[model samples]
Target chain A: MIRRFGSSQVSALLVGLVAVAAFAATYGFDPVPDGLPGLGAVEFPRLVCLLLAGMAVLLFLQESPPHDPETAPPIGRDAWMIFAACLAAVPLMATIGMLGTIAVFLVVAGRLWGETRWPLLVGVSLGMTAVIWLVFVKIFRLTLPGGWLFGG
Target chain B: MEAFLGGLAILLDPYVMLMVLLGTVLGIFVGALPGISGSTTIALLLPMTISMGPVPAICFLGAIYCAANFGGSITAIMVNAPGDPSASATALEGFKMAEKGQAGLALGMSAISSAIGGIVSIVVLIFAAPLLARAAYSFGPPEYFALALFGLSMCAAIGGDSALKNLMAAALGLLIATVGMDLTTGVERYAFGVMELSDGIGFVPVLIGLFAVGEMLDQATRRFGKPAIIALDAARVPGMAEMRKCWRSIWIGSGIGTFIGALPALGATTAALIGYNETKRWSKHQHEFGHGSIEGVAGPEAANNAAVGGSMVPTLALGIPGSATTAIILAGLIVQGVRPGPHLFTEQPTLLYAVFASMLAANIFYLVMGLTMAKFFARISLIPPAFLWPSVFALSLIGAYGPNQSMGDVWVMLAAGVVGLLFRRAGFSPAPLIMGLVLGGMVEETLKQSLLIFGDDLTGFLHRPIAMTLIVVTLAGLSWPLVARLLRGVRGARA
Candidate 1:
């Protein structure tokens, strides 16, 4: 017989499965040296994985109520857009440099968050990026990505 | 006494004084903004402190820590959006007071009580930390192992709604902590052939992702309804009569805050909740609760601020963080090459005392700054999220990259951000997970050493009385919820 699971249960199950995979990966560790002290590199991780899997199983068994309408609003398209933009900025930083990526990211994020005026968006995005560059890179002397394209 | 005087002199330096003032103001501004916490502020500032002297760096962070608690209450009172989770109880009564046009009075009460609480706790920390360190000086590997275990277990117990979920998150954290080369065996465990992974996951980047970026992502997804416009024209210092009325509640809350803050795992949020409840129970005007009572504002504000002092006790004496913010501070100390624990008190007595002195000065600054700026700060809640959050995101990105200058760390941050959002959605808090990761290395090393000494004999733990008692306490703490439920069930049946 097949059993249906809720979203929460499915998430728990996925976590448990991941733990099992990690547990299995521990087999590749070099065998413990003869008469060498306590449990080695693999033992503690193995134990943690076992406990994680067990707890995940228990979490899967617990029933949770469906989301209420007043709270827990559905994840909207704009939210996903913002998340994608953030994720994209990581790789973009490698190509365009920190300042360049941040300038573009701020504009895109502002637009996604419902800012309508193009001039304000452009000004704010560039202004914020410039201020951060001055403080973090110039004054503080901290290194930010210079991009492979810039000969950095 | 000389140490104390030396600490005061360090704080009084022109450069150090500037750092404290700037840190406190910045901390308040950031703390007043919804979705940013003192921990996140410290995380963002961590890399910048690398170039600073040890005394100035810690003093700066300590000023931020003390002031941020008060800063959180500003937005909580004005807009019903708590700047920190610990300020939620304050929001309940504070917002009501705002609606009734007592916003200024409520702000005054919170500021004053927070100052009182902070000062009281700093006193406790000054006296208690060295004594605790003196006691911890006798601890061997077995005792350290048991203490670490107790901390981890208590975190799981006190964190989030689900004990099982907290444990699972902590276990995941421990697993992550084991990613680098094993310190004992000198063998790579989970590096997966990546060069960066061999050095272990960078905690600073993870912290930025979890607290700052994750929060920004969560904020982007939701709708913030129109916030109340609090008029601060009437805002002023609490009158003598009002102060007289609320002093007792403030005192009691401070006491509660100090006690809870000293314990592992528990934090100001818990202290505030208990303080609020107790004040309500003992209040003569019980009807005033949830409807703009001065006592209501004073109680939780005092407690949470007092907890800052209380938490520093364990952090300095035992090298165990009492909260997520302190965990980051402890990380900052490690990055600065100053190991915290008993030796710190003995070896660097002036540094320890300097931190204490800085906190005392910060409380006075917070009171002055909070009251003087209440009018201006009340208007900050009106800032559009569209403008505010993007700036925050940019800062978070830079903050994550600042520590190691690794694009790899940035990628790790992005991944951690996604994971953090998913965990929050799944009803797991990141606090216990953080505690696990921070304490995991110490726990493993100490446990292994203890086992090596005992030759794998489980019964040998009983030879160390302190270790044995700590182990028993951990077990009892882990079982507390279940035991409480069972007792309630039996009592209900009899009824």
Candidate 2:
């Protein structure tokens, strides 16, 4: 029960901090231009921030019910690993080309999800990447990021 | 009548017909995949619309929007995986029917009822849009301000677990919307010296991040296990007896759906939930609810599909989106240089009527296609999440990067995906946030303009009857949850 309440409290605190940051950010905003009448840009955002802060307090005051352990599973290490691997592809795509990066990312993602058949993994990854490339890059004519490795 | 014929003529063109058919097929495929929403599909497809004519583009997107609503029920009924949040209510009784070897019956009921509901709502749209557009012409900034406030209040009321949390999420979204240069004063608000941030966050990238990548992240954490393989009995279309039994629920759901969908900020998810509850309450066989009731499947399925047509009314007439999918469609219209307002009805009657005709055609096509392909669509749920989600992730990346061809947008998508995952884990919903983001600019501009007109006397707004009434409605809506809780407590104490 305390753990559940703690989570709620943490979220409320985060919300409150965001509200404060929003209010604080208003200090940097230039004043409404001369001759412009009634309620500057800062006023509405400031009002929203105050309301947000008040709601954050109200949210904190409300007691959160205990979570059912059976239903709420703990985040596992593998999930974090997968998330990190996915995020890593962002930078990697800039190094390797789009098609190459996607091919590698899919194979790695499939492996992480417990698909161990190398032939199946390679075929699916390369096949899907090619199709997406052909459709999006070729047919749609939308520009995709071509990395330095591709000499674009 | 001439304008309607011109619209029909445009749709009769082979190219436009092909686009509509392709869009419907794509919509069904995407909607059958769990966690891939129709709005996300539209966001991904928005760039492709640039090459097409305005009529065919809007018509194609409209067909997808209409068909996707019905297609979501396919998986929801078969394997209990709701392809969209709006299909959750359908999944409750639908999976039960599947367990009882009546999957075909449930699917058939949903498909037929959806067609009925959609057709009814389309008829309403055809009649109501012109009237609504005329009324909308009289609306000034004050009225628009009040309308936006009411819409935002409804978002808090209908979304997430708690109203306070929803408000906070909306506030966050509003703050995010203020990131670029302030439109009013010609001064930058929160660009933080980044060149890319000057244009504000790209809408498509953020949408793809929130809906597609966020869902992928959530799916990654869960164990796939083995797919539930229910042996589908013969594809049994519901007979006239079954249809007759469900007609009342279908009509009631359609009515509720059409009314709610015409209201700003309330989407198909809320409509489906309310429709399910109302149908159960009025049902003669109420005990059959949650235990394979045909009415249960019909109610939500009909309501959700009906909402697709109903949502188009405000999008076309008032320049306000009634749902997220319509919001993206509105963006598509704006991109096509077709502003959605009263002028659209007057100036682009052919385009407007084409959209209406396409929706009608899509509804008829979906009924035929759905009945024929119900079993095949059901098999889609049997695919492992392991393989499916990775492809979704890949597609999300391409979608985020496609529009601007910018790595900056990709980074924004990644960051937004993280924020989305955190929001989900904390019991806060992204729906209200999305609503805030979509409405934020309109709210700010209208409020400023209203204030300029009123000249520091905020109470002067009370003189405007429509604006005042909407403000009052917003206040009541915001307070009703608290008032209901207090009344419940008092009743409990007295008892």
Candidate 3:
């Protein structure tokens, strides 16, 4: 028979492990000068890392509430698709620029989320892109990468 | 009085007043939308507010905070959906009122009670904040460190049902706060050779990712069904007789809301909940509660709106946030080069007073807006997730990128979004983490300073009367859950 751990238990253990690693890594921080020495710079992170590890242990040992549903979030295919599109915007903006990336991401995200009408998707995406450009670029005078392909 | 008058003078400026008006209108629409919260909206718009300069920016955000709580009751009354978590209690009787064809009465009363409660809390804030600031004048490093810890200790009770998870999230926040170069030692801790990380994680990107982008991802996963909504019964807006019946409930809610909101970790949601319960307990028409009692609609609406002003007190007076929105507002104030604390009363009277006056104006603005255009806002609650979430994402993208024009910030934002989702999956709240992140540096700095002052003696904390009192409270708070659990076990055995 195999014993299964719930997502909460697993997450707790993972965070605990990370806290331990974070504490160990703090050893690499630069030492405080001899003149001013109560708590060093690394002391604060170390304190928090230890607290995190302790809390993680407590969380791991804690029983799951019987009334509650499964601990894992209900991230279905569409949710992942939306996340992927958002992540892809970074590279797409680098390749095709901000406006182009917005349009592409919108169409892809819209389709994945079940917006079937091509004209509506394209029109809305275009409108969003135009609004973003006007507000971010024109009005606020903020910069988005013009893209190497767009020749700045 | 001088500061109050100066603030009114500033609020009278056309640009400042316009920002308040815009913020009130925008807050209502967003707050009436189920998924978009005031916190998310403020986060998405934070970077843009930079261009608006400090005064207008703060006023805009303040008005939004004030109006959003009242706006939430609009949807609760009409569609049985709470646009803000603070309005959940309102839905109990508010939806019943709607179903019984009394939505207009509920809507009108909610607005009226909300305005009254909000105005009452603002008056309290005007008198209370400076007094708190005066009290804080004698506080030293040790006292501040203990105070910050006391603030963090409340994390175990907030966010979600799981105390341990909330504490863990707060710890993660503290760790994140250590990312920047140490002010005293001038050594980078967590930057990992990234230049942007040396200044620490940007608050705007983290907030945008956590609230906006994170919520969008969550929204994409779930499907919601449209509930039967009641059309506005315009002819029967609450008359003076109804007001006579509800004055007691409204006052109870406002008092509870103001008290709860002023507490460090407590916020509008908690205030509204307690307000509902208390109003139910004290009402003359207790039998009418679940059957569309007008007092039921008025109580929580007033409480939640009142909580907006209540939450501002600690954020302004002590450099500690009272709620998530105020945390974001505190960040906005900091980015504008205004550090909020006891000194702000003396150093930035115009800014302080402006906040007070604008919040007062916002209550009036929303009262008028709610009474007149509630029908229009009621329809906006039905916005499809497809159109809404994507637009939010697009705006979030610009918001994260706009501040420093740094792509690194955008990447950080995306990462925070992922973390936010993971937090939800683990049944952790992002709120405690935010509070910790905001207060972490202060805790670390004050601790170090205290240590230096005490010649590295750990027992020095006991010598400071205020610090000692705060630490005692913090310890009691941290232990209460365990003690209560033990007591329950004993009682079970007795049974």
Candidate 4:
């Protein structure tokens, strides 16, 4: 039972529920104000929030199945580092646009992934930056920000 | 018939044909990338496609959708990871084939089955859509509500071993759907007072954050080292005997896909799983299913491709989305000023024909692209998680923010990513939740409309012949699982 409702899963669910409730409370009972005119007409995003909350509850209530902890693969420090890096990326991307952030992120990330050749790392990072810019900006013509530091 | 020919003439225009070809090739590359679903590719391309002529845009999008469904299998076959949810079943056998140095054969089978499924679905759609629309128009509000009920009920059919969780997820979706302003009363239920909350949450950011960013985070947390890329064998095509063995699974998969695709909410993943399980039940070596049987690869690949065609039925005929990708496609239709419904055929026969021809054109392109690009696409699995995760993260951010040029959407994407990560850790799928959110509004509106029209008389709900038939069908569908379980229990007791 302890294994099923591990500290990680429980805390995650609790956090999610609290966040959802807070989001709901921020606007009071009237969640959507600009909704299309009529009674009971719902839109997609609000529905997603509600579903996520419900899923959190359901997940919390679920009885944990038994498992042998020893047999499961070890969650290594390296994995955690990767997780930390991913989490940190949101803030970094917010500060720097895709090209600058990704270039730096890739070089560091590539080394973490066990790439030994510095030249390969630089080459790959530059190549990826070019491709993303060309495809998303040049070919597709989608608006991708370049941050305040560089002209978008 | 004449309309179809005219549409075909338009599709045959060199520029349109070129767009279809280019779209299919691009789709294969995107689909080959792990965690890049067909829907995301379409969403990303949508801004650009908006400017193109409607027929060409439809053709390009159709080609992309069809080819991407097959393209995901390339990575699944060459590596253990599924490129998209629909290819998850294929990865079981396909990756095993790669492990055994038969990667080429697995790739060949997936390509062939996908092509067959795509072509068959197009043929079915070309004929079945008009009839379905005609019958659906005979439906009153009550019947439409019943149809929504049927779609919602199928949520129970998704994922592994948790009908309760799926129901809970869907209910949560429906409840959240109520947060926006009440269409009838103009009162908001859960918005609090935030101005942004007034319009409700946007779909693109949420989708990008949940699926793209969430997936990258999950990949980051994996304990094992990434799968090593096996050296490519230049020539390793399947033998005739292997093709003969998989033919049965392919046909069964395609049939299941077409059937489920026609249903409003079931989508491709459901069809693929059902097809995979059904084929396994009929196979001589059923025990080998998850252990990497070729039948498993063939069935799922076929079903998923066919589902692409199947999911389009409602979108084209009724202006309803049968899946997430179709929902996005519906948005595109609205952007192009084409209102899809019962009157579409009469009001715009050439447009209808154009859509049909585009579907056919996409199928042919899928076959060509899948065959030529399989080996190259297979290489995507080798990119280290460090590089892959950050890049995908960047794309997720850009894609989420691109729609409205809002930094707020980017933050929303971040929040959704966190939520998505939590859902993954708890072993609950976010797919059904996402699907429910996309479909929830449509379902609720139809139900309320029906109730308003019928007043307090419950039996009046079934006054329409089509409505009565749909309600009965929905009831039967809901009871199917319980009935099957009971039968199994009874047989076991006797034994």
Listed per model in order, the count of residue pairs whose N, CA or C atoms clash below 3 Å is 0, 0, 0, 21
Q: Each prediction's TM-score against the native?
A: 0.97, 0.95, 0.96, 0.83
Query: Chain B, model 1, TM-score against the native?
Result: 0.97
What DockQ would you assign to candidate 2?
0.60
Superposed model 2: Cα runs more than 4 Å off: A1-5, A68-72, B489-495
lDDT of 4 by residue, A44-109 (tens): 334545656665665566565444342233456765676666567556755676567767777776
- Please tell me how candidate 2 rates in CAPRI terms: medium
For model 4 chain B, the run of ten residues with the poorest summed lDDT: B160-169
Candidate 2's displacement at residue B88, Å, is: 1.8
Expressed as tens digits, the lDDT of each residue in B1-495 for candidate 3 is 887899999999999999999899988988998877788878888886788878999999999999888778888888888988889999999999888878888889999999999999999999999999999999999999998898788777666757788888878888998997999888889777878999999888998898888888777777454556687735245788998999999999999999889888678888999999999999989999989899998888889888888989989999988887888888888888888999999899889999999999999999999988999989888766676788888888888888888889889899998888777766788888888889988999999999999998989998999999999999998899889999999999999
> Candidate 3, overall lDDT?
0.86
Candidate 3 per-residue lDDT, tens place, A1-152, comes to: 11366656777788988899889878877777777677878878988898888877777777755434344546788878788899989878888877787778888887877778899989899998998888777876777777777745
For model 2, residues A65-88, the per-residue Cα lDDT tens digits are: 466333235778777877987899
Candidates' C-alpha lDDT? 0.85, 0.82, 0.86, 0.71
Q: What is candidate 4's lDDT per residue for B1-495, written digit by digit as tens?
A: 998898899888998888888778778877877777887677656555655777777778788888888878887777766777788888878888777777877787888888888889888988888888887677666676676666666666665336655655555555545555666656665566656656666666766676677766666556346676656653245678888888899899999999888777667777888888888987877877766688888898899989988888887887656776776676567657787777787888787787778777777776665666566777766666656676777667667666677777777777877767765665555555655666666677676677667674557765677777777887888688779999999999999
Instruction: For model 3 chain A, give the 10-residue run with minimal summed lDDT.
Output: A64-73
| lDDT leader | 3
* Pairs in steric clash, model 1: none
Candidate achieving higher DockQ, 1 or 2: 1
Q: Is candidate 1 or candidate 2 better by TM-score?
A: 1
For candidate 4, please provide the TM-score of chain A on its own: 0.59
Q: Write the per-residue lDDT of candidate 1 for residues B1-495, one digit (tens) a residue.
A: 888898888888988888788778877887888877788788877777776888888988999999888888999999889887778889989999999988999998999999999999999999999999999999988998899888788677555657777777777878888888898888788888899999999888888788778778877878564576776774579999999889889998999999998887778888898889988888888999977888999999999999999999989899888887888888888878888999998899999998999999899998998888887776776777887887877887887788778888888888778877777666677777777888889888998899989998878999999999999999998888889999999999999
Candidate 1 vs candidate 4, lDDT winner: 1
